[model samples]
Target: MSYLVFEQVTKVYGAVEVVAPFDLDVPEGELVAFLGPSGCGKTTLMRMVGGLEPPSSGQILLRGERLKKPDRRRGMVFQSYSAFPWLTVAQNVAYGMRYRRDLSAAEKEEQVQHFLALVGLTDFASEWPNRISGGMRQRVAIARTLAAGSEILLMDEPFGALDAQRREFLQLELRRIQQEEGKTVIFVTHDVEEAAFLADRVIVFTRRPARILAEVDVTARLGASRTLELREGTDFFGLRNELLHYVRSTASEEEGTA
Candidate 1:
């Protein structure tokens, strides 16, 4: 079985469908990105995988087991800094473990501290959300998600709100973390370049009521790890332009049919 599978999936609200029927399979330990423009159902698809939303029709399976509701098996990072303003960074990270019966208070503290350091925020553990910069807050969000120890991560443009430099920095940091931990991640972003830099494969989607337009495997010479230099190469643009062309062609075809 695939590590993650979305089989003949569709989502609808009343009479309007938000996502067309689609099938996608992600292999174990792979990082894939769903790339498209705004309102193209990328976030919706991520939400389904995260168990925050259910498909109107079709099945979502992880490791061959059907996913029916939210569980700690999947971690998620939102585009917004979702930390509670009143809570300390440590408190924010520990919030995810409230339902777990396995960890003692000492163990939870240890895990929280470990994750805080993982995201380079051990020094700010006692600060409230408002005292931190936007980038730092985003790091806290990542640390919180990581602390949950979930095997799969569903990220919805986690660095979208940051400055370009910070976003790029975090992308490299995320690649390092994913490699060290061997986690399967599905990241959503509208930026094609971002997808190319971070993904093992990129799934491009059509506009509203989105469906997979094309799936491109990037064959850049990053040599098993992502790097900024890879993004500047000719091969990167070649793959990216191909995806852009496919998306445009699909959009035009849909318009013609309508």
Candidate 2:
């Protein structure tokens, strides 16, 4: 059975439907990227999975059980700087664990340290969020989410604000972390290359009333090694171009109809 399943899920606001009814199954430990143009309901679908927004119709199932509200099992990392300015890096990362009655103080600290190291933020553990760069803050956010023991991660363009160099670096780091930890991730991104480089499978969406246009398996083309060298390969460019074509074609279709 799939780890996460969206069955005939639809999202609407008033008379307008943003996400048309669609069905998708994401296997355990797979990193799936939702790629499309703006207002394509990628983020909206992610939010439903995260339980930040309820689906207007249909159900989102995790492990065959319907997900009604936000739970620690599914964590979210947003594009914005979500860390608290007043808290230190370690404190921010440990914040989510405070609610867990199952973990002792020592266990929480250990988990925090472990995840911080995974994101290469061990040295900055005592530093405040404002003291770190944008990329570092996002790292802290990811560490926090992981520390909460979330099996499914929903990231909404977490690296979209970073510069080219930092974005690329974080993309690699995120892939490494996901692989090592064996977490299922649903990432929303507008960047074609970002989707192609990071996802095991890329799910392309159409305009406003979003529906799956295609599912491109990156592993078949890029293989398991996600190094910087892979980005320079002809196959990578081919897949990237294919994703871009989907986005552009969808946009052209929308414009023609409008």
Candidate 3:
């Protein structure tokens, strides 16, 4: 069985249906990117998976059980870096473990250190969130999510706030962490390049009432190292161009037809 399954999931707000019947099966340890334009239902789908909102119908299952509410198993990071201003970076990471009864104090501290290091924030562990760059703040959010013991990661345009260089740098770091930790990641992004570089499979969505327009197998063709230099290769460009074409043309076509 797959790690996560979306079975005919749909979302409606009043008279408007923001998501049409959608189905997807995601295996464990794979990073899948939901790519689409603004106001599309890509983020809505991710929110459902994170247990932040109820689906109008159908179900999302993680490891064969239905998701009912937000918990530590599904950790979400948003575009906005929402860290507790009062907490230092290390404390913010530890905050996620507040309810965890499985780990002792020493073990929890060890995990906080581990995840902070994974996101390259070990040096800033004691610094307040305001002292860090936007990029670093995002990293802190990520470490916090991971340290919370979430098996699945839901990232909603997490790198959207950063500049190009910082975004690219984090993209590389994210891929490395995913590979090492073997956690399933569902990344939501409107940027074609970012999706191409991060996902093992890129599920490009149409405009409103989101549906999967296309799914590109990235790792099969481009491989998973996903280094900065790989972005310039012909294969990488091909994947990026392919996603861009779908986002541009499919979005325009779907806007009026449906």
- For candidate 1, the per-residue lDDT at 107 reads 98
Write down the RMSD of all candidates, one decimal each: 2.4, 1.4, 1.8
Tens-place lDDT per residue, model 2, 61-137, is: 98899998998999999999999899999999999797899999999888988988999999999999998999999
Pitting candidate 1 against candidate 3, the one with the higher TM-score is 3
* Candidate 1 CA-lDDT value: 0.85
Candidate 3 structure quality by residue, lDDT tens digits, 86-105: 99999999998999999999
| Candidate with maximal TM-score | 2
In order, the Cα lDDT scores of the candidates are 0.85, 0.93, 0.91
Least accurate 10 contiguous residues by lDDT in model 3: 249-258
Would you estimate the TM-scores of all the predictions?
Answer: 0.92, 0.97, 0.97
In lDDT terms, how accurate is model 3? 0.91
Error of 2 at 191 (Å): 0.1
Rank list by TM-score: 2, 3, 1
lDDT of 2 at 135: 99
**How well does candidate 1 match the true structure in TM-score terms?**
0.92
